[model samples]
Target chain A: MSAKPPASIDALIELLAKLPGLGPRSARRAVLHLVARRSQLLHPLAEAMTEVAATARECLNCGNIATGDLCPICLDDRRATGQICVVEDVADLWAMERGGAFGGRYHVLGGTLSALDAVGPEDLGLPRLADRIETEQVTEVILALGATVDGQTTAHYISDMLDGRTRVTSLAKGVPVGGELDYLDDGTIAAALAARTRL
Target chain B: MSAKPPASIDALIELLAKLPGLGPRSARRAVLHLVARRSQLLHPLAEAMTEVAATARECLNCGNIATGDLCPICLDDRRATGQICVVEDVADLWAMERGGAFGGRYHVLGGTLSALDAVGPEDLGLPRLADRIETEQVTEVILALGATVDGQTTAHYISDMLDGRTRVTSLAKGVPVGGELDYLDDGTIAAALAARTRL
Candidate 1:
C-alpha cells in the first residue's frame, strides 16, 4: 500500500500537529485514537469542539476564556474581591490557580512588554486593566508575571501605574514549589537563600 | 473568590480530564489555551471536533476507526495484500506505523482477551477476524501483540483458529521499545537478547 495517508486524514494530522507539544507522531496517534473511539470519544470530542468553536470567546475585561462576553470568574459575585492577580498570560494564571492559594479574580496581560518583539503596554491591555481597577473598586494588584526580563519590566511599569491607588505585590521568587532542593542549580539556591529575609 | 468553576465550564473540564494522559490540571490548562486562541486554534479545533463527532465511525470489519463504513486502510484496494497485523490496541498499531516498516492494513483487537476480567473471544472480536481471514483472502497474519500474558494468549488463540492455513508471525521480542534501552532492567535486557534471531 502507499505510505501516504488520505488527504482528509493528512489535513487532520497537520492541524493536530500544530497543537502545543503535539508533534507529527503524537498528532497521528491522537487522530487514530479519535478514529478508534469514534462513538465514545471522537464523536463527543468533535461535538464539544464545534460547540466551543462557535461559542468560545475571551472575557473582554480580564482576558480569561469565556463562552460569553465575560468568563465565569468575572461574572461570579463572590469573586468581586476588589483584588486582581495580574498575569502575563492565561498559562501563568493557570499555574497560579494550580497552586490553589489565591482567592481573587485575575487580569491576563495577553503578553509582556517585549522590546525585542516590539510589544508594549497597549498590546498587553494595561489601559483595560486600569479601567477595571477603577470600576471594580480594586484595592490591590498582585503581579504574577514571569521572572524573565520582559516580565520584570512589565511588572515594574504596572506597579508604577497603580502605585498609590492600589497596593502592589509580586509572586515570591526563590525556590520553585514542587521542585526538590537536589535539583536546584547553585545560582538558584544562592538566590533563594539570599532572598530569605523574612516570611 | 469562589473556588468552583462555572457549571458549563466545570462540566467540560470533567469530561476533558478523562482524556488519555490528561489530569484535571492539564484539562484546565488545555481549556484555557483553547479559549485564549478562540479565533485561530479554538474555533478550528472545535469545527473539526464537531464534524468528526457527527460523522466519525468505526470499521465494522477490523475494529479500526473510520469516517465511513470502513477505515481508509480497509477500503484501499492497494492495501489488500492478504496480510493483517493484529494488535492489542490502536496505540500498538500506531506505534508500528511510526516505525514505517509494515505496509499492509491492520486489525485493532481493541484489547487482548482477559480472563481475569472475564473477557472472551467474542469480546475481543475474534469471530469477526476469523471471518475476515477467509473473506479477505488473508495469507499471512502477523501478531504484533504485547508481551503480557493476555497478549500472548490472544496470539496463540488466533494462530490456532487459522489451523495452519495461513502464515503466522509475531513481532520479535527483547528490546525495550518507546524508551531508551539504558533504562531497561537486566531481566528485560536478557529476554530481548535471548529472543534475538537472524533476519
Candidate 2:
C-alpha cells in the first residue's frame, strides 16, 4: 500500500495503527479486510465505535467505563455492600467480577502510586476513596492491585491514609492455581509455603 | 472486560475481534485504549471508516479498490503503456507499486482461479481483462500472481484464454533478494539454479 492507497484509506491505516496490538502492516491488512466487508463489518463497526465514543464515560463513583453517571456495578442496588474492592483499573474490576466472589463495591485508583514516574495519591483519586469509605460505611478495603513493587507501595499508602478507620487487606501472594512446582519461581514457592494452610 | 462492559462497548469489542489479527482479549484492551482517548482516536477512526465505506468501490476497469469509477492508477494517463500487470489482489498491486519498477497499468484478478472453490475465470474478471488487452492494444501481459498451485493454474488459464494474442510472462521463481543460499529451501534453490542468469 505504498504508492497508491488513497488519502482516506491511508488515514484509516494510520489510526488503526495506533491501536494496542496492531502495527502499520497489520493495520493495513485489517483495513483491507474491513473495506472488503464494507457492508457487513466495516459500516457496522464504524457505527458501533461512533455510538461508544458518544455514550461511553467513566463512572463517577468507581472510574469504570459507563454509559451514564455510574457503571453497571455501581448502579446495581444489590452491590451496595459494606466492603470496597480497590483495583488499579477497570480491567482489574472486571476480572474480580468474573470471579463471582467479592460481593462489594469497587474503587478504581486509575493507576498505582509511582514515585519514579511522579504518580501520587491525588492523581490516583485517593481522596475520593477516603470519602467513599466514610460515606458508604465500608468495613473492608480489599486491595487487588498487582504484586509489583509500585502496587504494594500504593497499597501501603492507602492503608496508612485509612488509619484503621476500616480494615485493609490485599490479595494473597502464592502459587497460582494449576501452577506446577517445578515451573514455579522461587519467590512464589516461598510465598506459597509461607501462606500454607490445611485444606 | 468479561462481566460488565457496556453494551455498545461490547459490540465494538466483538467487531474488533473479527478483524484479521485482533483477538477477543486484544479487542478488549483496544476498546479500553480507544475509550480512554475518545476524542483523539475513537471518534476520528469511526469517521474515517464511515467516509471510506461511503466512497470506496472497485475500479470498473480493473478490480482494484477505488473511490471513483476508476482507481488512481486507471485514471493516470502515463500508466497506459500497452503493458498490463495481472495480480491476485489489490495488496499485490500495492506491492508492485512500492517496487516502483512497473509503469504499466494493473489488472487485479481479486483472487486466483480455484476449481475446488468453484471460482472460475469470470469471477476473477478474466473476460474484462481480455477486453482490456484488446481495447488498450496491450503488447505484453505480466503475470505477477504468487507461485502457489492455484496462482500458476490461474496464470495458465489466462495464457490459454489469450492463446498467444500477445506476449505473456510470469514472475521468475528463485531465492528472494537478500536471501542466503544456505537458508534457501530445496525448491527455491532448484528454481534459482534452473533460472540462473549471467551476472
Candidate 3:
C-alpha cells in the first residue's frame, strides 16, 4: 500500500487525533479538508497555530491562558468585585464568562482534588487561592466545580480552609453528577451562578 | 460583566471554533485543556504544528500535502503502477490508505465537478489528470469520489474522456447515499474496494 503520508501531514493528523472527540478517522478527515481548503482554511489555521504556539502561556495569577504574565481579567483592576470564582479548570472559567453574569476574577484550579489520582490542594493551587483571597481582599469565593465526589471534596476543603474569613458558595441547580462545566449551556451557568448557595 | 478572555487566548478560541464539528463552546474547552496539558500535549502539539506550518505544501502533481513540491507517493518510481485512484479530495485517498488496501498512487481532484457551484472539470483537475494518464501510462483510473450527484457526474465525465483507453472502476458497496469516504470504517472501506465493479 502506498499509504504513508508525508511526515509533516502525518504529524498533524496524529496531533489532531489527540483532541477531544476526534479519533484517527475524524482527524484524517479534518486534515484532508484543511489541505483542500488551503488558501481559506489550512493556510490561515496553520498560521494561527504557529502564532499561538509561539505566544500562548498560562497567566501566573489566574491559571488562565495569557499572552503575557497575567490574563486580561486578572490584570483589569475594574474586574475586582471582592469575589473570586474558583473553578476546576479553565474551561469552567470560560463557561462562567460565557454566562455573562460573573463580574469578578477567576481562579482556575487546573483540576479537582482527587485522592484516587493523588491530586491535592498543592497540586490544584489552593494555597495560592488562599493567598489571593487575602491579598485581593476577596469577600466571596464561588465554587464552580464538577458535581463529582472529588469536586465536592475539593469544594469542602476550600470552604474549610477559608472558614470564618469569607463567604463560600457553590453554584446551585442545573449541574448534574459528573457534569462538566464546559457541557453546561450559558443560561444554565448563569442561573447556577446567580442562585449560588452557601456551602 | 468582566468576562472577556485575553486577546491571544480569544484569538486561539476563534480559530479553533472554525474547525470541523467544534463549536465555540467546545473550542474554548479544547483551548483550556491544551493549556492545562501544556507540557505533555500542548507543547508537543504546538511544536509539531509550527514545524508543519512552516514546511507543508501541496503536492504539485496529486494535491496530497507534502513537505516538498511533490508528494512522496508521486515521487516514488515503484508506485507508478499504471493505475491512479481519482478521489474527490485528499481525505478519500487517506481513507483508502488507512484501510491498507490500495497499491496504486492517488490524484486528488480537490472536489467533484459541480455546475451548481460553478465548478467544472478544470476546477477538479481533469486536465492535469488526463496528462498524468497519458504520461504515466496509466491503464486504470479508480474513481473514489462520494456517492453524490456531483461524484457520479464527475465519474461519468472522466470515463467518457478516457473512453476505452483505460479500465474505470470505483470503490463500491457499503457506501451509503451521500456518504463520504472519510466517514466510513476501515473494514467497510476494504469491503467496498474489494467489491468494486467496473463503472
Give the candidate number with the greatest lDDT.
2
User: What CA RMSD would candidate 2 show?
Assistant: 1.7
lDDT for each residue of candidate 1 in B1-199, tens digit (9 for 90 to 100) = 3345444566666666655556777777777766667787877776666666566566777766566888777877878889899998766765787787887888888888888888899888888888888898999999999877888899999989877778988887676558678988787788888987789
Q: By the lDDT metric, which is better: model 2 or model 3? A: 2
DockQ of 2: 0.63
DockQ winner among the candidates?
2
> Which residue segments of model 1 deviate by more than 4 Å?
A3-9, A72-82, A91-105, A132-139, A163-199, B78-81, B91-105, B171-199
Model 2 lDDT tens row, B145-188:
99889998999999999877989988899988898999988999
True contacts kept of each: 0.30, 0.69, 0.48
Tens-place lDDT per residue, model 3, B48-151, is: 66666667788999987788999888888878999899987767777788887777889998888877899988887889989988889998999888777888
Per-model root-mean-square deviation over C-alphas: 4.6, 1.7, 6.5
Scored by TM-score, the top model is 2
Interface Cα RMSD, each model: 3.5, 2.5, 2.4
Off by over 4 Å in 2: B1-3
User: Least lDDT summed over 10 consecutive residues: which range in candidate 3 chain B?
Assistant: B1-10
Q: lDDT per model, in order?
A: 0.77, 0.89, 0.81
lDDT of 1 by residue, A22-118 (tens): 5777677777767666677776666666666677677888887677889878888887888899987766766677678887899999888988899
- Candidates ranked by DockQ, best first? 2, 3, 1
Give TM per candidate.
0.77, 0.97, 0.81
For residue A24, give model 1's deviation from the true position in Å. Answer: 3.3
Q: After superposition, how far is residue B92 of candidate 2 from its true place, in Å?
A: 1.2
Model 2 chain A: lowest-lDDT 10 consecutive positions: A1-10
The DockQ scores of all candidates, in the order shown, are 0.28, 0.63, 0.44
